[model samples]
Target: MDEDYDYFQELRDFLGGTFHQDISSPEQALDEYINEANKECLLFTIRYCDEFLTSNRTKQEKENYIQTNAEIYFPAIGLTPLIWLNNVVEQIKEAVKLK
Candidate 1:
């Protein structure tokens, strides 16, 4: 979990910095970039989880990693991070259901 936390913390910081530089106002940013941001977040989460699942980790570990990182990564876009994170989680769940 520590390793997962550290990896995601670094990813979160990088993405957060990028978003901060790209968007000046949260409202305007949401209006213009929400879809792209949400897509990126969802893709990242899915890819990360998929890769993690291929590793030696258990299913619970993969789930824990996703949940832990969601709190960090989803908010990187600077426009209602928690809400975006929730939306991303919902999207992920829906995708998993289709699989």
Candidate 2:
């Protein structure tokens, strides 16, 4: 976890520059899906989740919100969701395999 490694940018560069010819479309699709997910989150989902922290809302209100809209707060609905989630798991597996 070198702070300067710029993992996301380097990964994007490697995908866009090194393997551009082979995986450009798939990468773009994935990138677009990520962007759409970001939009979905910031506009609707985050505010909904943030309401849980509201001092104005009672505990019952928080419970109602969670009961009604928990799924939207789960994030990363498709494509790379699991891949994004288990990044540590994937890295650990790779490290073990390389050992």
Top TM-score: which candidate number? Answer: 1
lDDT of 1 by residue, 5-99 (tens): 54445445533543454566534443343344455454555554344445676656645554444334334555344344344445565654544
Which numbered prediction scores highest in lDDT against the true structure? 1
| Per-residue lDDT of model 2, residues 1-99, tens digit only | 233444334333423442233443434434443444444322332232233243376666544433342222224344332233233224333333433
How do all models score by TM-score? 0.29, 0.25
Pairs in steric clash, model 1: none
Regions of model 2 farther than 4 Å from truth:
1-36, 39-44, 70-99
Backbone clash tally for model 1?
Answer: 0
User: Worst ten-residue run, lDDT, model 2?
Assistant: 40-49
